[model samples]
Target: MTEIESATTPAAAHRRPASLRDWLAPPIPGSALWGWLGPLFVTLFAGFLRFDRLGVPKAVVFDETYYAKDAWALLKFGWEHKTVKDADSLLIRDGSDAKIWEDGASFVAHPPGGKWMIAIGEAIFGATPFGWRFTAALAGTLSVLILCRVARRMTGSTLLGCAAGLLLAVDGLAFVTSRTALLDVFVMFWVLAGFACLLIDRDRSRRALAEKVEDGVGGSLGPFVMHWWRVAAGVCLGLACAVKWSGIFFIAAFGIMVVLWDAGARRAARVRNPYAGAIGLDALPSFVSLVVVGLLTYLATWAGWIFKPGGWGRGEVAGNPLLRPLEAMPDLWRHHKDILDFHNGLTTAHTYQSWPWDWPILRRPVAFFYTEPRDDCAAARCSREILGIGTPAFWWGATIALIVLVGVWLVRRDWRAGAILLGFMAGWLPWFVPAFGDRTMFLFYATPMLPFMALAVALALGLLIGPARQATVHLARHAPSANRRLLGSAVAGAYLLMVLVNFAYFYPVLAAKIIPYEDWDARIWFNSWI
Candidate 1:
């Protein structure tokens, strides 16, 4: 035998076989203690990118004028109150009117769940740039950690997981969105976290089902009818929905996905009554846990509105005595009806607004901020400021990768590809329905799904590398050109280096730093980008 085979043969003979439980454990080849290092590195790298120069521009950009002030009001009054236009200037110019805020109601399109998170940051930082944006940056950083953990679990490779996290970190849109004070970042973080929780639940449930089958009570493959993880996933979905109503799509998609998974599991276990057991016993409780529990959690997010008297609609005082119960309801509740009406009626045209069909191509994008600086020697004329659009390479490559992943899943049945596709569908596809109704939306609405897009790219790269041979010795002895494997690794490593370099090149524009007109123009690439 060759040296490699001879060396492995003895170890193979002496090896104590692992139990089936060990096989079912996540493909964490490393010891459990070492596995956490990947996530830690991802978190640190993402944190550095988000927290560096976090207070630059030193003013609220875009929607921060509303959210930052509302967050402060939430801290001071225990609920959000109205603020005047140009509130950012007022808050920044002097400390004289720091505590002066209007007690009237504010009109808004989105829900109040994300506002509470922003309130936490304002409560601590006291309405400064750092205070309002800190939570968004922090959430963005933590999302990298979540992506690492989830990708590792899905692919059974910590290295691949770290790669996915790195891809997300280098994405210009993700970096900018994270650093800016925006509700969409929170929505992204919560949706990703919820999906990660469901993935964990899927693995745990599969292992539980396997154990039940081995115990010979394979009738329904369960001695227990209820599942705790399903309830936990329900709670995560509810929290995600609380952040944004769009989270309902994920809840519904994932709920159905889980039912399908249980059906597949029952069939694999050779149960004759698979459909009945999977649906009747397994699915009913799961539906209640996912849907009903999610509904309750979403309602709980409105507690402040329910309790407060001065909120938007809480002040209707002239209703009939018999209608007191409905009219005397909290101000926030009444405010919600008006907000809902506004959202439904927002069919007006906007210059930067884009259709969902155009979103995939990024045909039109909102300009978050723009400024033309005079007397700038840098460009021989002037400088420009910009903060909209996405990284062309990252988004375009991910777009192609998403298409490839669909084919890969169809032909190979790769579960990881399926999971990424599911997230993309849940986050992106539903926007098309509203777009058909002429709802005005921006490309930033696609921000929440960008991480999953990155994950799809990373997953495709992993597949390109093929299966791991890290623990295999027999194959190495038979293959002649062993050095070629290192070549493949080198190419992948070089590609990753290119991604990091590209991210650095765009960091200035992404952060809204003043750059020469020529430099800014070069980065624009397309007229529509301006």
Candidate 2:
């Protein structure tokens, strides 16, 4: 056995009971195709659900008006340009004479990266529903795969990885957000990829520590660098930031999380003054590899705007003798400053806006598509149109599971649990600060956080179904109550069934497939949901 394996093996043994301790490291076979079938199933299932009727509701749903049209503009001009009113109608009814943007420039909030993505679909399929929402569906489907990889890596169990992927696949919010043409899914995919990369780094770093200790291979070691993996994470996070500024929260959280892992590693390695060694060796290089590289990548996403002479804010500094030098500097630099200001100053109140507390409870879900029906129902009925609500059972159950993880982390100091919680906070909590003012943020923005929440819930579920605790082992012999263990397993299984059933119950609304108004109302359990 490798030295590192020998060293960590004992800890794994201690976690198991004396009976199973001899086989502490279970033999994980190398049936690569069979091993990955679970994650692939999850991905294909997510893909099928997302791609079904993807182009329906044929008009511009919430935010699609901006992104869809901009996507078309981007394809034509290589950058987003302003559109005239009623552009979607014009684009839909035979690609007609749409107004092209003049040299004056149009101001916009958020960055250009996501719209650029939407343009790719438009280039292939034209400015249609399928064209706009294609990328969102693809990203959402891929997130399930990434989550599976992450969970498998963390838990070392294919079962738990499949469980995590299944949980995310059934989430109503994730379902709705995935079907829509929005930037958040892209952000979620990148952030999830970054998290997966960090988890990989953790595993590799721990292995490296084990090797050092096993060989007594330590004493002021040089910077412990894994150049390619860290660089890949930086690139992914940079793309995330380009999608939405909320990604910055992830960069900070994951950065600190990894550094702390380093500290723990040094301690594990028995390094004298491990923190000092880590700071001098790992910190600065990591910052350069991750943060500096990420920032440059984010800037490069604005290249089209930089090159375009008539893009938004492109000529703000033009014509004035004093402003000539500033304008000549770079169009994107000026545009970025303006975009930043717009994001910071956005405190306007919105009707469907809700608080973070309301988020966990799914109190105020934004209805992305709603209609007052004329005569589309059973009982001479008035039907309310519907879309943009979270899966009640999944999210509510996840809240309960998150509470359980807090206790698990406190009692067991389980590093995996802590990592999951860190991701949850990074994606979900920071929005509350911006949410303080009356800004119009929807529950869909919470999409980025849903995977972590689902994972947290899965971790809790894993604990319940996992190997019996040492204390509980006596029950198999002394207590003479097989009923109790059976009951516990039954309860956990029932909860999983209920979550899936609930997801199915809400799937119609989530995908915005037209159903009876009363059926939609039946799904809306809370007044705040409307």
> Residue by residue across 138-248, what tens digits does model 1's lDDT show?
988999999988877766667777888888888777887787777888888887887787777777776676677667664643434457777777777787777777888
Candidate 2 lDDT by residue in tens digits, 1-530:
11012213334534443332123223342356755898999889989988888887676788887777777777776567767777878776654535634444457677777877777777777777887888888889999999987877666556667778888888877877787788888899999998887767766666666555555565665235453567778888988998898999999988887777777677655577778867877777678767998888887777666555566756433455555544545666776788777777877777788877788888898988876555544555544444676678888888988888899889877777788899899988898887776566777888888888878876776666553322443322223134554665577678878888988888777766556767778988888778
Question: Which 10-residue window of candidate 2 scores lowest in summed lDDT?
Answer: 1-10
Sequence-dependent TM-score of model 1: 0.88
Clashing pairs in 1: 313-335, 314-331
Residue-level error in angstroms, candidate 1, position 499:
2.2
- Evaluate model 2: give its TM-score: 0.87
Clashes of 1: 2
Residue 317 deviation, candidate 1, in Å? 11
